[model samples]
Target chain A: MKNWFRAAMAIFWKDILLETRTKDMLLAILIFSILVIVIFNFAISPTPKMIGFVAPGILWVAFILGGMFGLTRSFGLEREGGALKGLLLAPVGRDAIFYGKMAAMFTLMMVVEVIVFPVFAVLFNLSLWIPWLIPVAALTTLGIATIGTVFSAIAMNTRAREIMFPLLFLPVAIPTIIAAVETSGVAIRGVELAEMSRWIPFMGAIDAVFLVICPVAFNLIIED
Target chain B: MDDKPAIEINGLTKSYGRTGVLRGLDLKLDWGEVITILGSNGSGKTTLINIIGSLTKPDSGTVEFGGIGVRARATSIRRFIGVVTHEHLLYEHLTGYENLRFHADLFGISSADERIIIVARQLGVEARLNQLVGTLSHGTQKRIAIARALLHDPPLLIMDEPESGLDQEAQGMLDGVIRQLAESGCTVLTTTHNLDKGTAMSRRIAILREGRIVYDEDLKSSTGADGVKKAYASHSGESM
Candidate 1:
């Protein structure tokens, strides 16, 4: 157990350091997400009353789509010079590999979300006091990261992995995305964390199910 | 210490689509022994190496390493094995030092810095260790890959055509390194089409023909490449 944790942490830090050095995935993901928000700003002229309803959807669309892009390209790093083979050859358990990768995706997606939120506030002309939305978005991001990491791994060796990832990931992830949008809508409406009690438990349940199943699924995919 | 053979494979069979790669092949190596496998292209050398290293599962077979079942305990068994193949298996963006450090951490080595320095020095890549792997030449990258495989000082080493990209001097250095490792009681299994290097580096030579080992012989150290060339020609059915 100790070894597994150490190995997983090593992989996580390695991913972070590599991406930091190259600005490869992080910059591309951040730009595309902001581009998404900018494009939606022009397309959707929501009335003040409808802004609350539409902003969350647009926010999540940018988040999920940009995240999907990052998730799909993530494995290409491992695939390029066959770095995945080196990971497999290590003594680390397959579950450690999954968690390490999942944690990296979760962290990267969260970083993107942090930068995107204020831009979103400025563009949508809303108060940037949606602190409660962080937790809501976090729960949603965990679910997306779990599901996206697994599906990205599945599509890794495929020829058209970019297209295949969303096809496999989005359908399974709709429940989490819906929960994110709903809870953000609640948080954006100036409600306290206590008011999101209903949606929080639902998001928690979805994240729990994903956390339990995705790592085991990753093991089966790699070993078999 | 356990006294079983270092590696044991029985009735291993693998196929890809309609073409069979390994057909019920079997081979064994004892502790502290070295064996070189020679085979024609597409004759299952890589498949055999991959299966032994636990990179790929066999269609049907049982493989054991030091009395431990390979399929049942891959993660634990991996601690004692290191592999080098055609692929460099490296992250191009990270410096060579970082790549080795990452692997050392995964193998749970506490003294990662010292080990990385030692292996880099051994491979004559100490100067290039700080350079990104992508910026290095092919031979330099191959040397780094070799350094990564040796980073953990594993008991068993599986290499597939490891000398392909190396310069003549580096190849000679690798030959000496494998010899020294064998002398230090490591079990080495490698595949190469180069008969001279094969005969010089290993105590035993096995030739794979038609998905099976048709010839397995112990060398007398003075065994010349010309004699082994004839044996290889007869068994592997490739005109030398």
Candidate 2:
């Protein structure tokens, strides 16, 4: 058990080091997300009432698009040098690679969210300072990263990988995205946790199902 | 670790979408022997190595390591095998030292730093250890790939076309490294197109053609490079 955890952390650390040097995923996600927010800003009216009405959708869209970009690039790095084969050839368990990659994606998504959320709030002239928003974003990103990592691996070797990832990822992600947008809507309006408690359980359910299923699916798909 | 054969393949067969790669192939390597498979492109050399390395599954037959079937104990079998392919398999963003260290951690080598140093020095990559793999030359990258494969001291080393991009000096270094591994009782299976180098480094040579090993010979009786080349041409039906 200890060895498994150590192996997972080693993969995670390698990703962190590589990202620190290149910043490819982070930069791409950040730029694309910022562009998304900027486009939405111009597309929508800036009235306070208008911002409140559309803030959740815009915010979730930015997060999802940016997070998806990060997910796509995550596996691309592995494919570039045939590093996935090297990882698979190692003595480490396949689940360890799944966890490590999911963790890295989660971390990357969180970092991007942390940066993008405040900028989003400022741009939309809204408030997202509630503690509820944090958990909502965390749970939602966990679901995205979980499912996205699996599909990313699946699509990594495909000839049309860029087209294939979203086609596979978005449908499965609809439930989590819906829950996130709905909950974010409540949080943006400063509703009490009791009022949004219904959506929290649904989001948590999605997270639980995927957090269990994706790793197992990843193991099966990665093998010959 | 015992008196058993290091690797045994029995009637192995594989194909992709009606294109056969390995057709009823069988080979065996006793403990501490170095065998080089010589073949042209699409001749199933990589496919054979991949199956034995447990990186790919065969459509039929069995591969055993130390008398244990690979299908039932893949993870355990992988721990004993080190693989180097045509692809360097090193992360471009990470330094050579970092790449080796990461693989060592994955293999659970506690003495990773020491092992990385030793293997890197043996491959003469110690001086370039801190350089990013993407910025290094192909020869240097191949050296690091070799170092990564050797870090765990796996008993069975499998390499596919390991000499493709190497210079004469690096090729000489590779020969020495393979010889040293064999001397230390590590069984090595490598595929190469260079007849002379392959014959010189291996105790046995096999020519793979049309998805099967058509010619297998011991270096003892094969007089020199010319003999091996002629034999390869006759078996593979391709001029060297």
Candidate 3:
């Protein structure tokens, strides 16, 4: 157990350090997300009365798009640089590499959300500056990143990497994304924490199910 | 520290679809020995190594480490082995140091920071440790890959063409590492198409031809290098 933790921390920090130096992934995903949010704002004239009604959809759309971009960068770097084979040869447990990558990607997605939510709130004119949405955001990102990490590994091996990620990912990410959007919507509408219970539980359930499946599936995908 | 043979295989067979790769192959490798496998392309040299490394599943066979079945105790048995292939398996975006450290942590082998520095020096890659592997020369990257394999001090080291991309100097360095490993009582299994280098480095050599061992002999034999070449040529039906 101690060894696992140490190995996880090593992989986690290594990725963090790489991201810190490059900043390419964060820059691309953030710029792409903000552009999408800005385009949505311009395309839809969300008046004060209509803003709250559309806020959740906008947030969900932004996250789904942001996550897709994040997943591409996550595995693309490893695949392009030929680092995937090195990771495979390491004496570490294959599952640890899977979870470590999921964790790093999950953190990156959350950071993107943290940055985008405020920009989104102002653009949609929705009072979404709620404290409770933090956990909801974290849960949503975790679910998407977990499943996305696995699919990204799969897509990384394919001939059409750019097009394959979304086709393979969006369908599978639906349950988690919908549950997240619904819960965040409930929160934005100033629903009580207790009243928003169902969506949160649903999000947790989705996360729990995929988290267990992703690690096992990842081993099968990388073997080729 | 037991003196058992590092690897023993019996009737190892692997097939993809209707085609077979390894066909009831049998091998035995003992400690302090360096064995080189030579074969024409598609003769199942890589498949055999992959099975022994537990990277690929064999259709039917038994691989044993110190006489224990590979399938029954893969994890514990794996702790005794390491592998390096044409893939060099280093994360290109990460620095050489990061790659080594990650593998060290994975094997749960704790080494002082200085020890990592020492191994990097031994591989002539200490200066490149901070550089991203993607930016390093192929020879330098292969050295780092070799360093990662040695990080855990496994008793059996399996390398598939470790000298493939290396320059003459780097190849010489690789030979030194193999010899040093053997001198230290480690069993080394390597694959190469360079017949001269293979014969020079190994005490016993095995030639795989069309998924079967066509030649297995020791250095003391007077069969000469041409005899092994002709045997492989006749068996593979491919001109060298």
The Cα local distance difference test for each model comes to: 0.90, 0.89, 0.80
What TM-score does the first chain of candidate 1 have? 0.96
Candidate 1 local lDDT, A1-224, one digit each (tens): 99999999999999998889878788888998999999999898777888889999999999999898889977879997889999999999888999999999899999999999899999998888778797898899999999988999999978899888999999999999998988888888778667599889999999999999999999888874
lDDT of 3 by residue, B1-240 (tens): 365567889888889999988898988888777899988778898888788887777889889888788767665666678888777777777789888887777677755466678779879999889998889988898899888888878789999878788999888888898889999988999988777777777778888876778788876684766666666667767686
Query: Tens-digit lDDT track for model 1 on B76-95?
Result: 89989989999999999999
Residue A179 accuracy (lDDT) in model 1: 87
**Model number with the top lDDT:** 1
Models 1 onward score TM values of 0.97, 0.97, 0.93
Off by over 4 Å in 1: A192-195, B221-224
How accurately is candidate 1 docked according to DockQ?
Answer: 0.85
Off by over 4 Å in 3: A80-82, B1-4, B222-226, B238-240
- Per model, kept true contacts as a fraction are 0.89, 0.80, 0.46
Q: After superposition, how far is residue B13 of candidate 3 from its true place, in Å?
A: 1.9
Q: Could you tell me the TM-score of chain B in model 1?
A: 0.96
In model 1, the fraction of reference contacts reproduced equals 0.89
Poorest lDDT segment (10 consecutive residues) of candidate 3 chain A: A80-89
User: What is the iRMS for every candidate structure?
Assistant: 0.9, 0.8, 2.7
Please give the RMSD of candidate 2 to the true structure: 1.4
Q: What is the C-alpha lDDT profile of model 2 across A1-224, one tens digit per residue?
A: 88799899999999888898999889988988888998999888678776656888988898898888888888999986789989989877899999999999899889998988888878887764767899999999999999999999999979988899999999999999998988988888778668688999889988999989998999889998
Screening candidate 2 with a backbone cut-off below 3 angstroms (N, C-alpha, C), the clashing residue pairs are none
